[model samples]
Target: MSETTPVSELNEAEARAELARLAAQLQRANRLYHAEDAPELSDADYDALKRRNADIESLFPALKRPDSPSDQVGARAADGFSKVSHAVRMMSLGNGFDDDDIADFDRSIRKYLGLSSDAPLSYTAEPKIDGLSLSLRYEKGRLVQAATRGDGEVGENVTANARTVGDIPHDIENAPDIFEVRGEVYMSHADFDDLNARQVASGGKTFANPRNAAAGSLRQLDASITASRPLRFFAYAWGELSAPIAATQMEAIDRLRAFGFQTNDLTRLCPSLSDMLAHYRDIEAQRSTLGYDIDGVVYKVNDLALQARLGFRSTTPRWAIAHKFPAELAWTRLEGIDIQVGRTGALSPVARLHPVTVGGVVVSNATLHNEDYIAGRDAKGGAIRGGKDIRVGDWVQVYRAGDVIPKVADVDLSKRPKDSVPYAFPTKCPECGSDAIREDGDAVRRCTGGLICPAQAVEKLKHFVSRKAFDIEGLGAKQIEMFHGDPVLPINTPADIFTLQNRDASNLARLKNRDGWGETSASNLFAAIDEKRAIELGRLLFALGIRHVGEVGARDLALHYLDWDAMAQAIDAARPAALAQRKADAAEEAERQAAASDNRRARVKEARDAAIANSDVPPAAASAWSDLIGIDGIGTTLGLSLSDAFANPDERRAFDDLRQHLTIVSPDAPASDSPVAGKTVVFTGTLEKMTRAEAKARAEALGAKVSGSVSQKTDLLVAGPGAGSKAKKAADLGIETLDEDSWLQLIGDA
Candidate 1:
């Protein structure tokens, strides 16, 4: 699914896959910021990913993994620096994206504190500095050591580096006997600009932003290098203290200021939620003039006692939340448009932009959505950007918000270049020269060429060896690309990967003799391949790179069938049944279209006839077909993708060839004894007790099969208000029906 795919629209399979992808993305983002000190994600984009992860977890709490995005904070300490175990962990704060989120935070605090809804709660709101977090240790008014926040608990020892930062006090007076003052090490806007200018003059490597500059400078292995860089520190927190400095948050900031530390003057003590919000706005308004980078406003309970009562939740303080700013927009010239092909043969259009900075990240490219979006229309033909089409050489406004890739939000006609022309999106795959066609319901055009196309073939191979799939440790993406493009030892398929060592054994020019390959490395590569010969059924299935068969779906199939033979036989038996059902579904759809538009009925009927006549699908055995899709959460839609993967001759041959090289492990059966266990359940209409996702998660957790629609195999239907066709169908089919309240009682959620 696209990053912009709505959370509500995603099915269980999609949600699971999306969550896995997000985990990898967020982890990489953490490394980029904390380890490498080269931040790639903008504040808005990073905030969006976290929000999406939270939303999905709320909806499907059962599927939440141990290493969820929420659990990640900073990366591990870098190689050169000595690791320091923190006495008190440095934690990240939860974020609030909107005004409602702020209100919810307040309400949650009040509820947790057992206060009335209208009870007044005081808070201290301060700018969330965009910089490297530093912990400065001072004992008896003398600085001793300093460290960077690394994976929360352990940090890089940078005592010498910290001493070079200008705003950091070498020694402070009137401080606690043991004080670990925590603060942000940042480079001011003016200093950063001047530093970059000097770097350019000397042909030195310049930093991407002030935050990165500060981080890189402060983490330098050489103290002299850090001394040469202009960095400032702002003391706002304390990690470990021998004695309490103040009773309130604001007073503590003042105390830090009094102890020869630079503290934000904009920090305010808000007596009410409105005051907090007002202060946030005031700080935001003054942000550009502040001379330093700040992404959001951090709000914390003012009273220390209340803060203790609120306590913490793993990585974040329950008493505080960061109210993040919205997406930032920047104008850039549209240089050109490029078409990129993926594993699925999706011909995605990307805008090549004149490099411009948006919220600290330099973006030279943006996703154009699709041809419809370039023409200023949505999938539904609705006007977007006031119907102004994007073109090469046009001045376009790009925004990075909830999107992983920046998008062209608006095009300025006033700055249109006289030589600009309408972008002609490619009609064929540039890599393989194959026809690219857009399917009826699909917004993006896709290349018709499948595995034969190098773009799709290489991408599929990459996915086959992805971290969540086969995960051949040495055969990462770059290695996969190198192996695929090898003239003699080319790995074209999953089967080819296994056969490589055997093929190389017979070749005159050996793999070890190749450039960048050593005898030990070659032997290790072969050993890694041999090590994975006996593979888990779920991993094997997922590694096949079958359409719609993600990690969770593969596991579902693995658990259901237990072994490979059973799954293959069932798929073979169900083909005929699926064929008959498809025709019936087509007729039903045509009849509905007849009511909506008389003209579409004939056209749809003709199309259905053409599809059926051309289809080589054999009739299915009703029982087998039902069992194939009957697995809980493996509904008809995902089942169809699974079926198609095996039903096709080429794909089946490839699967069998790959299977020959591996010993597959059968998954353990779910040992649930609940009343709803193994029952096919369907949820429909406006559920008042819980959301659709919550309902699905509950049913699945109790070992029930959750289906999106009603069928003859459906055992139960949980109907809420406004339940329509599904409810009537359940009644007609004699399936058991339950209300929202009844469902909750049955699932023990009540």
Candidate 2:
């Protein structure tokens, strides 16, 4: 439906060939980037290849198989740790930009069940910690494995390093046979600063921030190296589990604490949205005081059943959302505004200010963002005159959003001097002397200069070799800027990076004579460059300088495609064919569905006659309905979401992407040691017989995974009235399930 021309059609053989080629190419790239920490391509180039591969798959849906190079989820085994396969796949959460998106998720839950708006709902509020995700597994009440959240199914083992954390328990009493707890691995603010100070003192590379350092440290090949770093853990979730320790989310936190895991004590339980908002505000007020990093507060539906009912989205759970705080603000004087041209010829405004502190750092300049951001008025209707025209004597408000770069918020009109006059915005680039044009619906005034502006080249080069890019060791942002436009070292593209090796001898010679550039460190820098020749696929993709592609996206592309050659070929050939096949499949599927519907209607008459002859419903009605509704852990919402997605043509196509790339290898889909495997059981009306929690635990111990409701496939349902709709649905489905009494009898008999 997009305006762009559809891709070409390809035969199945051709599609297969292209996919194969793409997989191999991408896989090689991934090895160089992720495993070796070197890069071969820019982010832009990688994104283009990914898009091409996606197009090919759109045409050839059947070819979009899981385990492709394009689906780069987990990396190869890290050197220092033993690898562990996850009992349950740890899927990443989907993101939302606004409150409306959250409300829509809530509505989806209602549509699945025939629920009205008044149905009471509650959510738990916790911080969305900005750090590395980890999984800790326990067996026989003893710590066994600690793993990074690799590809969701398999991860790098870090048990030895994890054991070093004082908060993690090495052993516990009365523990389940298997327990997998999930948490964030982070470096505390104080620890991060101290670590950086040490790095500076030792003349070693310092990380940009704590999050980066934590990830780097935890991923180190040596457990001893990880133990040396100031790392901490906070438990947030659980996977592969045996017993229920908590009745609610809050109680779960307490249980984790009792087990010797550290959890954020800042969590609060609120009765209403207003109260939740108040808590959010309180946290915002104390944001700077927190010892660790957090981007926002995550709100989750508190009730377990309700959360189950709300269920999960493809990426994130609908039961939870992150509420972010307002951007930090500060006041300062705007002395001047300068124009800088970009690679794409867009003119950007930079505001120069008298050095003023915002948050904790001195900011002498802030981004004006664009003409629209500057000239567009706020909700109160105050105009945003361009920062360029503001007189030198005027005061301005500066603000930083989510710890990002500062931006000019507004000009304080009250602080304007009587002698000040309104100045005109620039019509040309300040750096390149090129004509500037303003496009329709765009606030940006851009210069026509491309690859010609010194500022643009400097910024681009800096971004290209950034921490998340090629990750070149010697090329810091300052060094890149310093070399920019210098006649002696005029470097621009990624190719220029290779050229630097030629200057190694001369650079080392000059290093010994230069300020802050000693011979030993210079030698180390070149050696680091030599060490990064073989980059991984994902890192190569990230380094390509693509618009909108980041580290995570790059990784996704590599896993899905597998290798660079296959990826490149797919882009060059299969896209057109894949798209065409998708359209044909949609039509064929529709016809099949119509035929199936007709068959179902014919079967309905037979079903009615059979029901009348069987005639047991009159006596069975009461318990049958209850049994249908009494299955534990199953919810109507999840069922409905699954049904709707399967039923819709477009939704199916969209989810087809996940199917194409995601390799959900079930390690134990059919439980082997299930405690209640071959038993008939049921739960019934508010029994004090055993708490549902205790019963479920015992049943699982006996090899059972409890079903939410009764059905032909169900062995039993524990009934509780208010069992409501589930009971009726189960009876209609005609499942040979049992009730609480029968369930108890079997267990007692055992």
Candidate 3:
């Protein structure tokens, strides 16, 4: 849950944990999308999450999870009809989040091909259709079979539905004996609106978006239902083919067009990197007028030979990348600013704005992010949006980062009201009247009224039962809010939830007679709560909602410690040890910083050891602290957060009390048979055979734990050209060292 932690700051442990979190979240998101034909997460949020996952993988390739998000495609085809096993896999493209990602992509392509920067290269850029993927097969100019991409290798048969799509060619002239055309089945904005209006008139469930509408229409159980919807197909790619259609990407599109398949007219051929970027900008600028949803532009190496050489990753093609756009922007009047406290007590600022149409959606609220954001500064007080502060009655530009959550991108001082006053942020908790404090090195001001703050308590309760946590069916945000303020059955902490039914036993008549409550519903609620009494360790940890101890952190701790008592005992034992270490470290730092003393290193070590010797902290306690933080993915940041939570009397009482009612199940042991599975490895310098990331990934897949720096625990060091101080340290520590070739040989180059 390093949501705010920079990619560069992440260690292997944090990156791995975050990757696991992303895998589970993204998988659920994909299921909501493909299986349900609805988008639960916004496109922008999905891409952002994907980019975060990809970035972490690039940094810590070795820590990539077995269920890595990068390797995942869309959800498997929903169970219905017959499944079609694709002759060739239908792959996704790698994503380029920003201009820098594009640049890196280009660099990576060049490096992979061993070409110079100025080498001859050309690409084809096309609008990446936001729609359902379908593959159509033809035999001797006659349509034969059609299918939807089901998990990449398999798909659902949709030949009957494909015949009804107006844009699909029933028969093609002068075609190969066997040609498979692949493209996206989509609904235009006008068609989607018309369809929704018709559905409304007919009293049917309207689609969420054009993509959903198209997907639902195309995947109908009845072909007659598909024919009624105005669905369009854009054939941008081909699956299996009887013969080679063209030698280049642009030529292939042209061939597909000539074969009567509807192709995107906006597709273009670019001969250089600059052309690719310029075309992307051009497409983005004209996005709204396209009359169809397009998340981004796809760029592919035009040369067919180069593409063949490029091959593919586990899920994506190395030769192609999608350059996604940020959310659309529009001008809106900033009417007001509101502060809302989160479950963790961090106050967030939100803006109330005059409703404005942005990217076909009506937006009235924008995230101010924080107090610093409202004041036009970053975490370091650096200028943002040219240091322009936001105020009430000011005209501002609003945009959705993921086409869902709106944010104020910039302010227009020219339209500011003359009498506008500078707004001052609240210094106290708005809900509980407690002093809100911002600690040093922290960006957010948090409420000090932990249990007393109604906002925090309610939100925390909601989180405890959220889909990612305990997942109690009857307890949702609405229920949490009602129960938090209820006079007869008030829920104030995690413990309250478990003891709710018992507390209400004598008052069952009162509960059953209440508004929105009946005897049956009340019994069901209690049953739901009782069913979760025996919970997994990870779910319990995440349900507690301790700061920085998110889903990934909780899972990692659960995997390492196995049970609640083990983790709690370690947390308890680590506090004094951590304090003693902190004190000793401070004393040594002070000694070292004193004016250039002779034998500075010796004196610093002596000062540290002496401080540790004088302190009452036990060696066993120190070992416990080390072990707690040493768990893979458990770093100093999370370790300290755990200590702080346990150290606080209120959090400890709540956590312990909640545990009293639940049976915590130990996590299953993870067994890996890789040679390096238990060994710690440090990779340094330049790798010739593969990029540093790829090398790390390779080593990690074989069971090695990659570290950023050389340390005492390092069992091996993989060094290449320009091996630096890390290599020297490895040699000094007598750790085994391997060259690129030897390392590859050891792993059998798998």
Candidate 4:
């Protein structure tokens, strides 16, 4: 009988008995996989068992067992290590989805600290490693025991196998008599590939990915098998200690490395939340390039003193977090594909998906990105990926990548139903009925509709009034959502936001009674909106929803242009060159489109010429279109986007109309001789009195551009608390490190 036999085929007692038996077997298998790195079953067989367990649990929810293999930890422990109890339990972090989730986590942390809403705090960030956890014990400069991080309370012993790994040191000079180090065990991509090849050659089952391979290798019942597989370790935490080692977490990591344990070289110390985000982005950009697999980054407070005060939450630490990367990839159906026009005139392809949950988010749509994404059919006439196309109703895989955007991956041709049909990618904009054209050297199809698209208008308005935009107080997301749907509000554009002042009070008075709002809040919001009738030039530029012009870009534009009128004039004048270049680029792209359109070679030339002459680049307006790129921050891509937006006569008219209603404010210019100007400071180890935010803000006030994650360019590191990985990375890179007091002295605070 198959392990997947349904519970309906057996009596309740038999089902329960089978479940118990399977649960035990699964647990043993998991122990071998996670703790010992030795697996009797293949990856496919293990997955099958796991699936069976999941099915049984779903069928008998009430009879579910607590100690099921599903509940066991993932993969294998670190190599060349011994098990040791954590000085403080190293718990995993909770995850966040959108900015709201992040904000909520921030709020909860503040509440735990008995802080008010505005109380400032600093944070450190690092990538969360996707590997097994292990504990290593050391005795007076000598190696001792290594064990898997079992249930926080008890773990299975694996000291003998751990000793065979080469990266871990057998002894350290002047080490404390007793201490435990904790770290992750993982396989590099190359090692995983080589190990899998060896397994295949030896007539053994191959591993799936590095994570699976490492897990399988670490759990072997026999020590020799583990010794044969290539494994690595990165120490991140300490368990128990005979005596005090480092004064802070950063120092602890240094001590671990000094004792000869392999640790991650990219760990960073982020003194504030903003710096932490920057670090996260840096790590994300390097994710694919990194040799080893990283599920996410781990962040720990640099101040050990603060950490000791805040301590652990239920399962994780209050002073640390695991910022995870996206990983929800599964095969589903690509039911249909459609074109969407954005406010900025960029056209994108959207896939109507057979609803699926990826990375804990329910996704029914995935972005195809551009025209280049469609058309090319695989052998099955489905979407050729890499160079493939997918058809309607084809079973396609989707993944919700780190940025929360979902995209199509592949198709299961054999499972595709006979009724499925080829998907027709639209040749025109769906929102405004404009001709969609593929530009030169471009992979996307853009709508010639420009500013008239309802979809574009609504999205733009939403962005304009967003908290980071004009920050119009009373106009929250719910309110904006209501305004988009209501005929009375008719707030369709940024200009429409100013028109809302003339709206009847009855339309908005109802909001005062809603949740999280009151008369005071509502009135305050209206007041805030009124106050922003005039805004800093940078904020207005960003609020206009210009493509690629984010906060930094806006700041640059403001710095160069000085005011809104100047900025607008520059863009208006540069429209001609932007238009000509776009047309030129479009002519080249049409060739690719022609090949994908059908197999007719003769029609390709004719289509290319005609499309170029009538490309998505609208006609430019004299000198008014030649000055947009004169500003420093404007790039070719942004210039092209702006030119496209203003090229349309209607869009130009709208821009003029919108320009009349707003007033732009100029910020005070900065002076030279600022103390912190041109200096890069990093924070490491522990800080005694001031919060990380205060330190960063003070540095900024003195004109410093504070960056997160130490690098060669990093001038100083302000360390506090459990500043582990970053300190080590900084030291390795020869970056200067500063304790909190030294930082204060350098800044003249002393």
Number of clashing pairs, model 1? 4
CA lDDT, candidate 4, residue 498:
69
User: What TM-score do all the candidates reach, one by one?
Assistant: 0.57, 0.41, 0.62, 0.48
lDDT, ranked from best to worst: 1, 3, 4, 2
lDDT, candidate 1, 578-633, per-residue tens: 76556655655656556456655556656666655655555447667777776656
The alpha-carbon lDDT assigned to residue 87 of candidate 1 equals 95
RMSD to truth, every model:
11.3, 20.7, 10.7, 17.6
| lDDT tens readout by residue for model 3, 1-750 | 325344443444466577778788899898878777877877877875776687766544445677777777787888886899989899887777568788898899887776769989888999999999999999998998999887788888999999999989989998778999999999999999999999999999998899999998888999999999999999999888888999999999999999998999999999889999999999999999999999999999999988887788889999999888876679989999888887778987788888887766576776787888888999877899999999999999986554234668899999999999877888899989989987544678899777778888776776677667887877766677777878888888988888888874666676789889899988888899899999889878887888888776787688667778878888888888877766786777667755245655677788889988988988778778877776555676678778878887887888889888999998653356766675777778777777665666566566566666666777888898989998998889899999888888877883
Show where candidate 4 strays beyond 4 Å.
Answer: 1-171, 174-182, 185-333, 338-367, 377-388, 397-407, 414-421, 485-487, 503-525, 583-633, 674-750
The sequence of per-residue lDDT tens digits that candidate 4 reaches over residues 77-193 is 335343444444545454543344455666666655545676556555656777777777888877778777665545546777778777877778877788888888888998988
Query: Model 3 Cα displacement at 7 (Å)?
Result: 25
Best-to-worst ranking by TM-score: 3, 1, 4, 2
Tell me the whole-model lDDT of each prediction, alpha carbons only: 0.81, 0.59, 0.81, 0.65
- Candidate 1: which stretches are off by over 4 Å? 1-71, 74-323, 401-404, 417-421, 576-623, 670-750
Q: At residue 251, give the lDDT of candidate 4.
A: 75
Better of 1 and 3 by TM-score: 3
After TM-score superposition, the amount by which residue 521's alpha carbon in candidate 2 deviates from its true location, in angstroms, is 59
